[model samples]
Target: MQHLLLVAATILTSDPVPEDEDVVAGWPGFVIFIGLILAVAVLGYFLTKQLKRTEANRKAGVFGPVDDEEPRDPEEPRS
Candidate 1:
């Protein structure tokens, strides 16, 4: 068993370890394409929802700024 283990270790140590650059170069385009698809999807979703809300608000009449009571005197220093 010890001899077998020694032979395996020697084989493994003699082989060159794989490098990151080779792995990264193989998949760079796939990563960038996925990122672009994700970004377009998110932006489209938000813009669609915003447009829908604006249309609904326009129909509801209570769309603009609020007009409640009077403004307090700013002269009083806040604690």
Candidate 2:
């Protein structure tokens, strides 16, 4: 049993592909290409949505300035 297992393991681990063989050919390649394009498009859509939301928040003063009080002269002492 041990010898059988050893032989089987050696055969399974050996390199299966020959130099002449082409990888990712035909229909499989087309499917992968389309999947990659769709992934990028979906990512871009969400990114654009987030950026627009942030811009809207900024314009609406969701992020307040450092000084809420009116701008004072530099020489004026802080109360």
Candidate 3:
């Protein structure tokens, strides 16, 4: 957990950058930090939406045989 925070802190650089060069430096840094966070959140939302849709499609019918053949009891004969 500590390592993960450290990496995030590193990615959100706090080194002073000139206002004129602020575009990429992210000036106060929180600017880009917030943007990056939002971007990830939006992507995550869309990803989960897709995942749910796929899971719904994969859901099995509640009242039908699972496969083409009828499910047989353990005691049923094959002969």
Candidate 4:
């Protein structure tokens, strides 16, 4: 219909201006962003430390026998 076409054309041509032109992420947003970055950094540091300790423990055979040794049978008595 002609009325529908006219309405569509008007809608397409119209550019609605915003009430506040200077919209921005303020100080609170900046602070939260900084906090997230710091949290990730701290978590990464702790994770690295724990991973190093675990690697050291593994090399020292804390978990069990070394990889080169054959696994012992459960039914066999220890010497």
Using TM-score as the measure, the top candidate is 4
In model 4, residue pairs whose N, Cα or C atoms come closer than 3 Å (at least 3 residues apart or on different chains), thus clashing, are: none
Q: Which residue segments of model 3 deviate by more than 4 Å?
A: 1-28, 60-79
Clashes of each: 0, 0, 0, 0
How far off is residue 3 in model 1, in Å?
62
Which of 1 and 2 is ahead in TM-score? Answer: 2
In candidate 2, list every pair of residues with a backbone clash.
none
Better of 2 and 3 by lDDT: 2
**What TM-score, to 2 decimals, does candidate 3 have?**
0.41
Q: Candidate 4's residue-wise lDDT over 1-79, tens digit each? A: 9999999999988967656856778999999999999999999999999999998898799977565568788899866
Cα error of candidate 4 at position 72, Å? 16
Q: Write the per-residue lDDT of candidate 1 for residues 1-79, one digit (tens) a residue.
A: 9999999999999999788775554467889889999999999999999999987786666666432355656896544
Relative to the true structure, candidate 2 reaches a TM of: 0.52
lDDT of each: 0.80, 0.84, 0.74, 0.87
TM-score of 1: 0.45
Off by over 4 Å in 4: 1-20, 68-79
Give the TM-score comparing model 4 with the true structure, all chains together.
0.57
- Poorest lDDT segment (10 consecutive residues) of candidate 3: 59-68
- lDDT for position 36 in model 4: 100
